[model samples]
Target chain A: MLAKEIIKKIKDAESNITSVIFVGCGASKADLYPAKYFLEENSTKIRTSLYTANEFNYATPKAVNSNCIVITASLGGTTPETVQATSKAKSLGAYVITLTHKKDSPITKDADYVIVHGFEKSYAEKLEKMIYALQLAVEILNQFEGYANYEEMINGFNNIYDLIEKSAATVLPQAKEFANSYKDENVIYLMSSGATHKVAYSTSICLLMEMQWMNSGSFHDGEFFHGPFEIVDKDVPFILFMNEGKTRPMDSRALTFLKRFGAKTTVIDAKDFGITSVISEKVADYFSPMLISGIFRVYAEQLAIARNHPLTKRRYMWKLEY
Target chain B: MLAKEIIKKIKDAESNITSVIFVGCGASKADLYPAKYFLEENSTKIRTSLYTANEFNYATPKAVNSNCIVITASLGGTTPETVQATSKAKSLGAYVITLTHKKDSPITKDADYVIVHGFEKSYAEKLEKMIYALQLAVEILNQFEGYANYEEMINGFNNIYDLIEKSAATVLPQAKEFANSYKDENVIYLMSSGATHKVAYSTSICLLMEMQWMNSGSFHDGEFFHGPFEIVDKDVPFILFMNEGKTRPMDSRALTFLKRFGAKTTVIDAKDFGITSVISEKVADYFSPMLISGIFRVYAEQLAIARNHPLTKRRYMWKLEY
Candidate 1:
């Protein structure tokens, strides 16, 4: 499904959008930028709502007269919502784009632009592709242009990936103890911000998709308020990030706050942040700490696999609107 | 925080409301669609959470004024979440628009459209901003012409929001059960679909931000079934969607299945769905679910107040240049 035209369309349509809409389901909701954040970042008018194609007949956003842009991302391109919304948007006169694993699907033809995600050979590949496609979509509002921070992001990703691999070799031997760490574990919270926010997103995806498949939540240091902050206590196990480049005091305060809740909070950061005598070195905040996220994913994935759950979650399946 | 030109800008930006609607801790999230189904059917982008200002900052969509269609809401221009995200988007050439309590705040200048959610001031003023701002936004997209759906949505919001005057209301009263049902509760799950998806978003927010002031998780039935399904068997309290839409099947499967695990499941929907409902009908599957989402805030807020915590959390607030 990978195509240069999709990337070009992303580059072209990002600026032309007076308003933008996103249609998808499942992890896509959490993985995509918060509408408020994405729209505010892109200068495009944006709104995000979870749509079910079956409900497309209901009154929805008018895409008439070339007023806005509507985009779709579905591995199958057959999600009822994606299909119906594209049809509706087209009828309303809005420009449309499709991001999917199967480009030959009907959705691709209906869309004004189709971005195909590569690596959909299997469920794992499809899941990763789902992430990649949206990342590509979200990052399209790139500030640097021409893959500005892409190289940096790749470097960061590789660094984290390597560290995680090495760490998993050593720490995963304690899989039983790691599994025993939370005897009464009620829930797992993934807290991240700044550079690690996207890392947290990836971490969270791995988390929900793999180990501790217990319900998980991902939020920045700032979002814990407005309501969810009230639930943090000893019963919940939290995975929080400490980024000096992000919110230092709050990250620290969050550690303290989570501590008061009695959550066995595992701080994700460079080993130096751990008050040890060694393992301290300087690396870009975005790159180094990301390794911790990757490590956590590795550990969690191992734990989940030991427990026998597919990283792509095949234990049980769900049926969408056929 | 209120300004005239900003309001004028909002009216002008209505044409840009093709697909995006901005939501946050304040008025931004308060916007209501005529039906939950409508919003669910149309949305293509999703963004918002806390602020670096609110902890939700930077966790949004990209912005480019002419290119990005956008919506923003905040009762107080000073809210960290909206301000920072809005400012960042402005830097990206976003047409910053807002539903705010003031005119002079940073949002008006950055936004192309500014809708004045001019109303009585209170912590709840945020509700007005969210609902009306969203209504105006989606109304601007009305294909019905003469804004029929827009007017219906506005009326629907008023119908629901005003219900707040009654203490016995579904959402408010059910919220009163928080202590009885959730206090000391180890794990809680918020399940939903369609526009009500954010209903769980609010629930997850409360769990993490209020009770033990801890971490929380949100899951859809399909995702929960994929792998996380096994966790629903015990010790988990869940809130599921029993809305009048296609979401019912999966949610029902979750409800029926999760009940076997001893997880407390609350279904939010009309009476037809039974006490199994999660939030309530006033807040349903379409975009206007935010109306019920508004009440959910008060529900959680009242719980927080009753818990005798600080009531207003001021931990991670940020300072911005705007």
Candidate 2:
């Protein structure tokens, strides 16, 4: 019911505050249209933070205030974080905006603006639709003066989606091979540089959240030199992601280090792997590689199933004891 | 025994590189000092890529060439990655440099230069001594010509140790209370923005690798709006590393969001907690937040131990299956 009000909230908040902080989980992202990368690619001047739900109780004054607006994303609307953080933001004087599937859902009721969408299906469809709705909502918000032909920018979304489709075709087979290599291997190591650092983070997260229930972690190339080197072994399988020139040796050396540990190591190039390329150089200046790396949702699904997790609905979503 | 040589190797490469590629795994990073961050923070012309080990195998042209130099880090000097990548770099005519703690490490024999180091036993001592060694090595490499003044930086190292000791005195004790709050509860979330992002990432990794036996993840305040909202729970325990000034609202909102999910989020503010205050603002720009965030390590330990998992020694000096 508040979907229309959603645009008004975002528009009004555009310039007044000293800064705008965009906060959401993965579902809050904008769609690239034909592409899914747009959500992570856009240039946002606002102050922003994205973290799992129910984790912000410790925020400093710099992170919350009356001038601020909190936008949260989740399909079910009843997620523990949505229920708690939204309520708290309002108590703290910050307006709350939520993008979800139902206006009646738990996360939406207290929102100053709520964009209720139907993109609530399996994970893949969930991404396609949620991103689409958010992009449209964002487009409407851009309608005020000085908002350049935002539609044109949103149109590029298609290019990203097309690229993802193509990349899936190319990398899927290879990813399958990589998955098999690590099947019984116990641990799969992901190493990356550039914007890919974010991807490594997301991929590792997915491995824990829905994919392989294995021991996993990510690191910036040279950072590993600080301590992680003590555990490298032949049985651990490692994967390195390299962007053209930015982190050449960093990502490369990770491959070498894995070999020394006796783990099997594989490398993925950002250029050849276009699907997740939503993280391409387009949004490079705004973020580290992990922004685009979230696209590994696709790659993660494959690996998840490869590890026999397959992320079924039967798998309890929250099942929180608290 | 080879620690001195390892330092020399790093120092030697600082000037030789026209374009440098830095690489290693998450664990090997225990010994690395941010020479690249330091170099890039100071000079804009030099190209650098600090990557995780095993990432290079997938790198593009700029990553490997006769002119490019590749450096890999491994604490044990035997990460499977370092060995594999060293051979590749050599075959490609790229100079190879290895940094580690063992002179007899398998990685040492093949590298063009090998450097090694070991730390003292106490928690603070191990971290402080190793960090100083890395600084000594990189500072010398960053400006080998200014080796004379390098001693000044090493002198400052002891000051950092004193700062950590002071902070740990107050920070660690309070962490016990925070840790107790979540010990019986399920889930732990970590979040932050900017350099604090590294803290969030590192926090997640530390929990998983060290004490955490449950769930955790990181997201930017701005990006969390897209999707992660679905998982929030009212009872899940979490923390937000609120950076001072520009990055707080999102942090606060994240806290709010978590509360809405029925979870309580804790925040560690750098400004109020004497975190950013301990170090000079300039140094705080690069390192203070990480130290502040490490406070979670103690809390995580308490949380895990409550559940009987307790951060133990097994994952500490992880021995590879070589």
- Candidate whose lDDT is highest: 2
Instruction: Judging by TM-score against the true structure, name the best candidate.
Output: 1
TM-score each candidate. 0.64, 0.50
**Least accurate stretch of 10 residues (summed lDDT) in model 1 chain B?**
B43-52
- What RMSD does model 1 have? 8.0
Question: Per-residue CA lDDT of candidate 1, range B106-143, in tens?
Answer: 66666556666655643235456545554544543343
User: What's the lDDT of the predicted structure labeled candidate 1?
Assistant: 0.50
Worst 10 residues of 1 chain A by lDDT: A274-283
Which 10 consecutive residues of model 2 chain B have the lowest summed lDDT? B38-47
- Candidate 2 docking quality: incorrect, acceptable, medium or high: incorrect
True lDDT of residue A161, candidate 1: 35
Give the lDDT of residue A312 in candidate 2: 48
lDDT of 2 by residue, A83-122 (tens): 6777777677676666677668888767776766555343
